[model samples]
Target: MALVGPLLAVVVLTAAPAGVKAGELPWPKWLVAGVVAAAGVLVAVWTPLVKARTDALAARTTREAEREAQAEAALGRLPTLKRKALLVRDMNDRALLGIHEAIPLPTDSDSDNTLSAELPTYVPRDIDADLRAALEARSRTGGFVLLVGPAASGKTRCAYEAIRAVLPHWRLLMPPDGATLNEMVAGDADLKHSVVWLNETQNFLAGEDCLKASMVRRLLADTTKPVILIGTIWPTFYDQLRIRVTTADEESEGGHAFDKDARGILELARRFSLGKWSDQEWDRAKEMQSVDPRIRQASLHRGQTGLTQILSAAPELVHRWEQAETPFGQAAITAAVAARRCNHPENMPIAIIEALAKEFLTDFQRATAKEDWLTDALMWACRPVHHSGGIAPLQAYGKNMGQIDGYRVSDILVDHKSKSAPIPDGQIAPDIWETLAESATPQACLLIGMGAYSAGVLGVARSAWERAANTGNAEAMAPLGVLLHNEGDAEGARTWWQQGADAGNTGAMTALGAMLHDEGDVEGARTWFIRASNAGNANAMTNLAGVLYHQGDTEGARTWWQQAADEGDADGTAALANFLYDQGDTEGARTRWQQAADEGNTQAMANLGVLLANKGDIEGARTFYTRASNAGNANAMTSLGMLLSREGDAEGARALWQQAADEGNTQAMTLLGIALDREGDAEGARALWQQAADEGNTYAMTVLGVALDREGDTEGARALWQQAADEGNDMAAQALRGFIEVEE
Candidate 1:
């Protein structure tokens, strides 16, 4: 029985992993030998020891097998659309009718009537546009994109948009969420090769939910697919963000300046969406501005102020039918909507509203069965939106918080009258999950709700990390340490880091090493870094070289930097270029930088462009700089701004520089200061230069010193020049000595 038990356990355990080939696993040998050994040990003096060793070996084997399985799973990810494409191609099937099979049919009532409530196709997909573009590019070439956006800033919208765009390429196997971000990134997609956009990048990064980072880092190594990460960070978060800024003034200025008061959402909305508001409508909207600014300003269609987002997003029938003209008109509609909602709360879903407003005369609607589409839309709209940050829970009806109890609508209304619950709670629970999970099959219907809650909670899970860490789980430790590291609690993260590292957690080792290095513990960091590097953590190797370089270990830095460069760190390439240039190997530096520039490092492009321009390769420089500018490089913006200003677009150039300065670019500020001074606003120039100098800019110091000298503040100018000179500014130092008459 004991021998049989061992064989059964091995067979059972192996089944979960690639199913052990029949007889391939030495089940009988191990089982019989283990049983005989156990009996002998029991008869002697080591039953406990033998059992412990056996169990430990079994556990390790299981873990190793699980690890390999997870790695394989990680390698298999693809977004939803691409998966469909791959399926179609591989199976020699062309029919896409199966896609809609996942959407549910309404059981309580006819879904046709509800299909009227989804956002119209015309609803702006800008939130999704960038990523969708990236995703499409990735379909053929492959790459990964990191998308960042504020809560409700629409990361998922972008994901869906990409799905729609890549619908035609059904031959590519893209899973709904993609196989893995790492797998996507391995393609080396950029503007040229692939469209790789990540939505809600924080969720896709160093978090328990995101296991794709390793593979993504691997994808990042690809030269063919360059990825752009899009996200929205809180202002403070953005402040902490580090970007290598080096644009021309004109391109850098206008958009990102730090004014005391930011442009409010209402103001931005008005600018972007209400520009098409009619004269009378605008006046009416102004007249109807309520005492309550929150309500009046918050709604996209407050009063008659702008094109009714409701009307704009509405299907032609509703647009023509519902006219919310005066305070009376809006009030009437609100009253009607509210009255019916209270009366027929059951049908008051936003999906119905959206469906009612969308273009209904389309065959696509027919194909998906409007009923199924409406059912899907309703569920999607009704779902809790946790990532909208602090946005009030979106009501199932409209942007306004009216439930027929709050207001009413005058337009075509369906009374959602319900006297009592229609079914038992258990019945409805399964129904809800079944309807919703139908759209995505990976989640089991019975387990649908549990899966979603688990996914969401796991996505941000951290409180449970310590427990998981104590239990020796690597995934939990890697991200918890990362979180601590990010929070500036490096020491607090160390214990877990060591535990995880010992357990083979690559991310923990990399993170811990980075933390130690950052705190000036180079030797301690190097040991951890080496372990991570050996374990295939590219970031660790790159960071190790950086630490070495900073400590002036030239040869050590070079050797490690080569490892990082081989593994694809643009920073490694840039650093090597600078190092070579500093060592007087200009030709090598230029060539190396040109290669990096070709890989879409905006800074490299700008640097190479500047180099080429200085060497009179103006056309080539322009080409490279233009690409860099388009990628949102502030330095390139500033450079382009300067180039444009030289060509006489002074105002435009000034505008660009203004943006860069706002984003805290001191270099751009210095340039803008000079431009203003040249334009006769000496005081403005002085103010800007002072700000830049305060930001630790030596160039700004030189400019301020020069300006102060020109303004006749000779002593102050001398002090400024001396500061700049101390930082190796030859011009400032030369002028300082000459002005002081201290040097022959």
Candidate 2:
């Protein structure tokens, strides 16, 4: 009956649809309940999926924040060489087979090549005789010797002569480069008593070779053994090496080269210069060449004039090779030219040469394999280089422009005037500046600007810097600000630095902090200093520590200083040592000072000398003071003089004081005057005393006053004595009172 009623209602609605509207048709309540239950099921299924996605997004955001925090922490820490130890150690694992392949063993006619039993005849120069004696003396104690000279200056011959005289029974072991040398030392027990000679030693001493520094450290460490390490260097290469000079005098005096890497080498080695052959030596060399076959073969071109000719032929030979029709020669010449232009010598990696060949000599003949092409290139470069083995081994290569596999050309051929040492008042040519401004990249302009700055060409530097700064490159920011500051635009400098700081430049932040500190806005300086320090500026870390210490946060300051020292900052090490000394940790301070001194921190060297002297280690103190004084530390000169005087070497003390006075040290002037007075040089003593007195030295004033009184210059004596007494000089007071009594 229900089916029949529903059917009847549907039929009625369908029949009335054309003209009739009907009210709600109600049949059953069960249909409506079923629809509502289905909708609830759909809602239930979607809820968990949405919640899962939300949870995943939240977890991802948390992980990103944690990663950002870790990144910041890593950025805050300073770069250290600690990580390089493992890398340097691993470099020693390279096989030794390829290293010594460059320089073949000496060969005789149709016989196997071997070191000669007969002593190599050498035309004995003063330096050669000294080297020979020194080598013989240190043969049993594993001392280092550096033979530095110009190209073809017979340095290698000197090495051979020295080794033959010193270690006649010992085998000659010449590993190709620093890495192989280190490997040989580590793996071969026989090297303990052997003569290890490294020729063209600049290859090893370049800063990119960490293994070389490591090798020097190891050689210096075990000096008790009978191993002798000798190396020959080009004079130009030696000049290019980093020297840690702390004072203006040191720079002016052409400072001693003992950077972080070179320090160990310098400490262990006694340096000897092989001068160009004198006219007498050259004549003697001709006579020796007739008697000695070794000398005859080594000196094929004869003396210094012939050697210079051979060296000058390098670029000409390269040009000739380039002008040749053959692709191999052209490719070789191109690579050599590229290397020369880049200022890298003989340190070109094979792979880099090949890459360059591929780029520059794409259509070259394929008559030889790619390897032969590189060999040909080196073979051509070596043609004009006398006394050099025909080909450089792969190990001779070093980073070019900091690229691992790049190649360097022979430096002898390159026109060096363009890269000459900057003259203090040098001016860049108008054409040079125009070319640089017109064609150079932004980065290149910045480098040009730096060069100008170094050469004291301020106008050119400003122009270049302005050009670079307009590009909005971040590196130019702080340097431009520095130029502005130097030009007396303090507010402009601050504005530029602030802008750079806002752009996240740590250098600019440091510059701002330094300026503020100089201006006595210490609180503002601290804020900028902290920001730069947290961004991993080593200078800023030291600056922050200084400000913190000034503000009485001693512990916090100590923490920052320790952080800086751990990062291997020389200044930071010195500062930390001072802090430790203040805190009564003398031993700790000594350890830190030693570390800093070894790194060539001039202040640390002077400080270490003082500390060692206090500890009754006079010899150690003398060593440090001599090193610091050589680096032009006036304080060290004065201290060293005092020590020499204490040891009864008055002449030596006086000489050091004279040197210090020449460097504008008032204390040295006063002391030297006293020494001169004792030596009965009354006029010289008076002049020095007068100069020192003018510089506000109380002792000098009193001494000068007494000398003037003795010389009958009563008015001058009275004035000098009165001024000195006013400055709290007891001697001056006594002298002044004596003059007053005499006047009465």
Candidate 3:
């Protein structure tokens, strides 16, 4: 509309003759000139305005095109499938492929065809309803659902069916690794109503960029866009993640510092267990046998093996490896099996297996072996016996880029070996240990050492740790020292600890300081403790506080304790509470103790109970005491028993005292003995007192001495009283003086 006025003015100006002038045409010359000038001004102003609009429109179109291209690229990069577009058959093909790497069944048909090519008819288990319900709830309120079981127990299959049944329209996002999954969650990708499929969940909970508790919290945080994280894991991995690592655990040789984030993440999961098929499930499988040939074949061994195990060809895989036709092939498989047993389970390098295989071969076999023996052996190990699936005794991984990275022994074969019997300690070949020590990564060596240590195989543990320590692994040093200390090699332990401490290993420094303190070198202990504390070791800070407290530096001790507590050390928090309680800060002590108790500190719970009881809050005291006692705190048990006794619940008190005594609580033993004596069971009382006194209980000594004196055994009573008094038991000292006066 703006251009129309300019166009009309140009047309009018062109129509007028230039020579005739404006005056000869319509009106006066001045008016004509004014009209021409007006037309010129309008044309000049409108040209640039139209050009600007044209440029803007073209730029906008270009930007829209670029944005669309970017959206396409992002969609291509995403490891997700839209549920509405996803075909169930494709999902079955990918998700259930190699669900359990079992031995392939021998067949005359094509090797690429196997039972796993098409999933067998589903026989619903008892857990199905509950699992479905959980999945359904996840759709509304986002959550993590973990299915835990052994290998080939149908965990993956069951979880797959449940998702299909309850959340068929939800999108599925399967990240290739933990890092990628973390990226997806942390990125601006739309995760609404997405099912995060994590098969073999341990892989997703490991490594530097693994899925963490904080990431999970973020993933499930917004209720408006719910996400369902469904995963399958072996029971062992789940147990490892669930077990809390304590200070004692951090100090022990076999103890591993579990990933706190991984532990926390598992705690958020709604877990369900899937075990072997029961009689009812088996009956259901029987009814489906006519529909599926695989089911019919698996039903024959229903009692002997799991139905899922049969379908996955677990038994056949075990048999194939055990009865290998070639000696070299058998040796290679055996080496792989041994490597897995020693904790080198995943991505085992081919070079290591090749080196270890020779040790397993017989003298005759080694001498007669061909130049291409290794090549032939590996081929035999990896050959598929099944008609159509990639089923082999030893499955190769990392082959996508042409270079084979490593091979993993079929899980069923490893599972079978584990269930049969563990290879006795020291029975693992020396050559196997030597090869692993020389070739295994430092981290792998540490794991191998821990496994060996837990199995009471000290020699292997020592070898493994030595290898790792030689590689300058500071983490391995303190544990090596712990191994030596446990073996009564104090000098060796001190030597390793000194080396480790010099290497700036905080654990080693803390451990060395503890040893020095135990040997009566308080100043030396304090020095190392300070160094470790300065290095940001929380345990060291707690130890430093204790040293300062013993040195009568109460203010200094409190400072270190506060620092440790701030670092989230539960022991430090509990210790700080104790300090506050001693300083008569009742409210502060109660607050700190409550914090520690909530963090799973049993001692804090017992101490809190005592404080409540002193304040005449008996019911509150009982609650804390019961909580602590149920968590296996013997001290809490004894205290609760005393509380019960005061409340006139004699039977309950005696039962709690007996439980505490059984757990080696000497105070409980002494108290129970007195009760037994009152109940007219003199012999039981004497036995209890003797046991407690043997364990160095001074009160038990005094009681036992009085009982002996009453029975006319003056000499025995005198000996007991003298022993207890020498140990600084004041009651025993007074009892002895009175006894002497009576004798005189």
Candidate 4:
């Protein structure tokens, strides 16, 4: 098109020359020059336009090809797209499926057995309504829905059915591990209207290459590309991940830092907890017995066991363990159960299990055991009880990882055994504890100790910690010392603390210093506190400040308190607030107290209430006092009681005072005594006053002395007054002077 104008100009010039003399002008020179320049302009404008159109066509074609490739890759990444019902049936084959597969029913040769192979009909759970609502919300805006429950409680099945009902056609992208999940999320895969299937969510949220909270947040934030992240987790893992890290825990040597990303991701989830099947759900299952033989068999055990558990072959697994033919196999299974009961890790090392098995065998069985007893035990324990899908009592894992191969006891069996008796605590043999302590890894021992401590199995905790501490686990030492101190073995606690401090554990140093300070070794406490504070322990800095303040180093105390408070220590912040209040910085004190109280410091809440009350903000004071009192702050209770009494709510005041007094608050006891006296319970008031006075409450002593003087026990009153005055009680001193003058 650009050449057309130029070619036409040439033709016109040639024709003009033919009609006229050669080299003679056909028109004025200006007209000729203008015509040629116009053709040049057309050529210059049209050439780039043509090139641009060609380039655009090529780019469009390339984009189409890339889109095609991406579509194929996305399809490859998500191979599990099918009808919702078919997907539900297919999920039965998944080993890590949170819902256990049902045990098959027996079929006779001539029976109408068309439904023999099918899974039991899905009985709707009580939590299904809420689960479905969350899944439905995912379609409008992306969401993460997590179902937490015990093993085989059907959490996964509920989530699966909910998604099936809501987003049935959305492609399911089931990543094999956390790394793959992270990559799939981070990649440029078109995840719109897709379901990210995470069956055992802990596998994705924990360990290396775990899915990050930020990634999930980014995914959900994009409304244009909504994707449903649905997963199931055990209650234990959910609790473990979502645990808040306390200030003390953060500063402790053995304490764990919160798994922030895991917790954050969990927090974003619309969580549903599934419990045992309700009687209604079981009745629903019974109504469907005619449809599936498996449901019929499971229904027979409705009153005896959980219908879900029965459907999931929990009984069959238990039978397999209890009715093993070989003694060696039974012993091995029993040992594994015992280990699990003792809070041992799920992945029990093969060697540890084999060694522990011998203890379970009778003397005759042990003596008659074959050379290949372990081999036989492994085969028996690892063999699947059902023809398909159902798990064994013990399943061997970690085949490829050298030195990490072990057996995982079925959680169903563990739960079943636990229901029969208290686990890992009550009546557990000492030998089992000894064996576990001796055979388990230091990390495993630490975990066992924690579990035992939480369960109040102090003996087990002591044993586990002793083993862990013996293995040079510095983090174990401080906790061991604490356990010892709690058990009244102060000398033993000191020894372990010394060992931990020697290993450079700042928590242990702080703990030892606090203990020494309590025991009147001020210089020794000071030395350890200085070491820990220098090592960047905020708790130590706060404790050191308290010691310094007591030792008359006021400025030094202030400096250390400031440093600790700057590091976000709630105790230090509260202490600094107190110091500022003493220094007449009321506003500064209030600011620090507010900061500390916001951090969940109960004492700070109580103190802040006091400050507010002093400023005549009674309502504001009551709000804080109520908050602190509900958190079990006895001092707050006392203050709140006083406010209520002034407001003429004597009943409310008495309630609070009695509760505080029961918690051994001396001020509460004294105040309650006064209230009792006003109520005409003079004997009760005197009894309370005597108790408070015995606790060294000077006010209680003076009040009780006045009561005794009224009762004509002048000597008793005089003695109480003299004792209170010796403790620098000004009111008691004046009363004693008056009593002495009257006696003269």
Candidates' lDDT values, in order? 0.43, 0.55, 0.68, 0.68
Q: Across residues 1-744, which tens digit of lDDT does each residue of candidate 3 receive?
A: 000011011001110001011111121111121011101010000011234335545765675565455434444554434523343233765434336543333354333343553566678988999999988887997999999987889888888888889887777766666666655554535678888878888767753345655457667867889999988887766765554432342421112233445665776789999877799999999998766666777898989778988888877777777778887888787778777656564778888788888888879988999999988899899987575677777877796787778788876665564433223331566567767666777767876675566555668878888888877876677778877776788888788788888999776888788778778776676667777776556667777776666556667678878887765566677778777866778799789989778766676787777677766787998898899889887777777877777667778888988998998777678778867877888889889999999988776887788788778898998899899889766567877887777768
Clashing pairs in 4: none
- Evaluate model 1: give its lDDT: 0.43
Model 4: weakest 10-residue lDDT segment is 37-46
Better of 1 and 3 by lDDT: 3
lDDT of 3: 0.68
Model 1 scores a TM of 0.44
Q: Write the per-residue lDDT of candidate 1 for residues 241-276, one digit (tens) a residue.
A: 222111122122111111101111011110101123
Q: Is candidate 1 or candidate 2 better by TM-score?
A: 2
Query: Where does candidate 3 stray beyond 4 Å?
Result: 1-98, 101-123, 132-146, 159-232, 236-271, 283-301, 355-371, 398-402, 418-443, 489-601, 604-632, 640-744
TM-score of each: 0.44, 0.47, 0.62, 0.60
TM-score preference between candidates 3 and 4, better one: 3
Ranking by TM-score: 3, 4, 2, 1
User: Stretches of candidate 1 above 4 Å error?
Assistant: 1-473, 476-503, 583-599, 742-744
TM-score of 4: 0.60
Question: What TM-score does model 2 achieve against the real structure?
Answer: 0.47
Q: Write the per-residue lDDT of candidate 4 for residues 260-363, one digit (tens) a residue.
A: 45765787788888877788899889888777777787888877777778877787777777777887887788788777756677789887788789887889
What is the Cα-based lDDT of residue 519 in candidate 3?
81
Better of 1 and 4 by TM-score: 4
